[model samples]
Target: MKLSSFAVPILSASTAFALSKLPRPHRRAPIVHDVCGSLNSDLILNEVIDSLGRATVAGHIEVCLCLSDVVKFVESNIVAQEAVKLLGDHVKVEALISGMITGLPTGSHCSYPDHARALCTDSNPCDFECTDGYLAFPPEKPTSCKCPNHLMECDGKCGHFKECPSKAPPSRRGNEPQCAAGRTMCGIPGTSTGQPWKCVDVTTDPTTCGGCLNASPFGNAPVAGVNCEDIKGVIPGTVACGNGRCIVKDCAEGFFVAPASDACIPVPEYATVDSNQQSGEAIPGSAGSIEGPKVSRDELTAALKHGAGIAIAHFGGPVGGLKTPRDVTSGIQHGTGVLVKPVEGTSAGFKATRDVGLAHGAAKSLTAGHMGAFAGTHGIRGVDGGLIPGAGTCAKGV
Candidate 1:
């Protein structure tokens, strides 16, 4: 307390504390993680949004360039993840990157105003003048631009630009005039503008069969046109336009062209003979309309063939031998005999029969007789042996 050796040190420490408490010039804190910090992040994001707005107003190419710059900055700085998090959705980030990569202008000559001006200088000044049939682009670039009547340019050399080819037929360039050879300019119905017309080949265009069938180009009533490809029941790729008319070359399965008509009609189901030799035709009974179950021709054929085979096999061997050519021919008409018992002493007969039945069932018609014979042939003689009842009859039981 009496001015010892620590007295000067204590005075200096107090003075330093007082100075620390005094107000001083403010300084910003160092940014952490670069622009990932909230303040810097928002500032960069705002700058990007502003640039995008200006670029959009400028044109498509400008927007592309702006997006490309943003992408390059984010990637080069290793902050793509941070940018995506700030954007709040990876899809938006992906879309931005995609837009930057695709649909951008190509070639070296400049068309953008700012870029074109950068290429101009005192020594290599812009001509702002071009020969007849040619024009100065950008009014700043020194390059002389020329293109055909169908071409155009702002500040760079002109060239033809076409849309990607389509997969369908009648492939042609999108920039080509629709009213070229083999095509007619037909006005769209309900449209007043002459520019709303479409070009089509009325002679071969299936949709505009005969002429501008749906258009009233001359201000008259629209001509009705048939879309041949839209004809019901006509096989796809089988209908065509000929001489301005829809010509159906073929009808789809289960359909037929009615006599003296171009339309397709369903095939009529015919009546068949039932038990007691009665025709299976529909009739109006007291209760209601009575009709027999319809059988397809294919089904009937398969049933008859299956039944005839069983009958022949049962009778051909022991009941009566094939003594004449007619008997042989009749047996031949039917398919191979259905086996009632497996071949004796063969270990594989049961498995082989089962496999054959499965194969035939999938590849061709499998009837009750086939299943029953398959079981019985393998010496199976219980309920399983009669897998299907009425194994060898041609009636509905089959």
Candidate 2:
């Protein structure tokens, strides 16, 4: 039978059967409608058969399909490869392949992730851990993460990857992971799992360390956990995982750097006000424990005003020789602190900000610089002279 003005022949008996069941509608060219008037219906039903027909469309032609129908079409006697190749474009080809193999429940096609490189399905019985690239699956396996290419299993704690140390004692040779076209290799050998010895690129693999298991690189020791106790050495500094590498950041105030355990311990005299330490334990402070001379808050404030230079925010630092802009990083520090909040039904608030200028906080009212009809968004502005910033509310943000 003929479809539209273009006379393409249907080669397979199954396709011909499906097309015969399609209802006759001609005004809009090609519009598929189910006999039940439902969006989803069985593939074998005749009422929705013609809905799949397309004469031709202008501009960007798009194709939407039911996963079950796709499976039915490919499984038909039609020459699947030749028929699909006739459509061309890698995207269309992938969609058909993925839809057929996914085989999710009737209405579950809408929840697919990237299916360009590989066809994925949650068929594996995951008793252990799944990787980061995986997706929502049956509850028996609560956590399921998948990847485009690698790291799709629970903690396969494969030994230190080659990119890490290169020459370690038990790095394992020839026992590398091999993945099929669409699957990634994961898991460790001789570990908790009875599974074989296979691993993926954990450095970037979200499912393995930083992404799933939360393990980070710690020198050459057997894939160390990203926690401070597991990775830190003799230096008393804070360790954080950024871009997959464990970095040493500045320790918290009042704690001295211990290079030995790579952790910060609270110093006795520096303990003031009995603050809670990093370990989540509270420590009491006594003024009698003060070994050095104490300075009053007014005296310290006076000293900062007199001695400091370069009234800038913070000095950005480099990690692994890579320097990120101060504005992009969260570590940007201001010379003085300010608080900005949303005030409702307060035209006086906007007038209050514009009239006093940005740096200084004089409390007189004038009307100007209407940010918007709703909320006014202001940024931090540069202060005028070395005037120590008061409880100044910046107007136009810099």
Candidate 3:
């Protein structure tokens, strides 16, 4: 090999001056090795020695003994004589140099995390290399590999790119319920019977499911006991707070529905008598007390058909409704028109009792064109919530 054919591309004169000061025993005097274009070639120990007269030339060789040529100049003293064997490595110049100079990988896939270890091929290039799940970064210097997508590095291995792995739970935005005024019920993830979250229960919203909200458990959660059954098909007659928590009250035996009080009250002659029924017991202008047998459901029904009104004279019986709901032959009515507290929250208000002042004289008859004209001479006479027309005796709202 012609040693003169090699060239160095040194960076600074000072670097070359510093390296040229090495002792060149006897083969020279004060060896001010300029390391410029010079003449010095020798073939000894079967190892070739090239000229190191220049620390900076033009071609492949960089500093006098750059890493690229470390393997070629192997004679123990040859490094000291020909070049600064290895400029950067602290190891002995003799050990650092090798005879093999095969370059890095040339194909893309043949590349390894270590550029020097990568295999060169027609397709793969050894200029850069990165482990799986990582990419070469910084065009200026790609000696290091970085995991993309901020993924965690595990066991010296790069995990999935930047993306987080799926955990046990898929994830949800929040505990928001599926329906308004309801709760969101969630089930365990990845289970056969695990159900998706949905809205349920009136325990959170007394308005829903007829006060079912009252039966709700912790934080108004939906449970099996929360069933609003009583007010079932009661549409306009719908499930109401008839005594609350979907509990509907029944009439005490004989008292039919007064039609007014979604409540049930006692019949006129049941245990006592009102001072209104026609009696000659003589209270003068008063209807007088009735000391007789308990009026039957039929009698009340008949009176209801005859423009007779019923009002809750007083409150407090052991019942919840103002009067108490009765099982009228007519039907149950909604809006009990009584003041009762509902399950707090937004609907915490009162329901007033319906008014029953006079009999229609005839159902909806304004023929009298008078205010008190259709009213019964005694107490309120028109039946509540009923329009018996010519029959005139429907009493309501007891």
Q: Give the number of the best model, judged by lDDT.
A: 1
Candidate 1 has its poorest 10 consecutive residues by lDDT at 31-40
Clashes of 3: 52
Local distance difference test scores for all models: 0.39, 0.31, 0.32
What is the number of residue pairs that collide in model 1? 7
RMSD of 2: 23.6
lDDT of 1 by residue, 210-307 (tens): 77756634333346667777778888787778777777778987566544335665543321122112333322222322222344445434433433
Q: After superposition, how far is residue 123 of candidate 3 from its true place, in Å?
A: 57
Q: What is the lDDT for 182 in model 3?
A: 33
TM-score for candidate 3:
0.19
List the RMSD of every prediction in angstroms: 27.6, 23.6, 29.0
Clashes of 2: 23
What are the runs in model 3 whose C-alpha is more than 4 Å off? Answer: 1-177, 180-211, 214-255, 258-261, 266-398
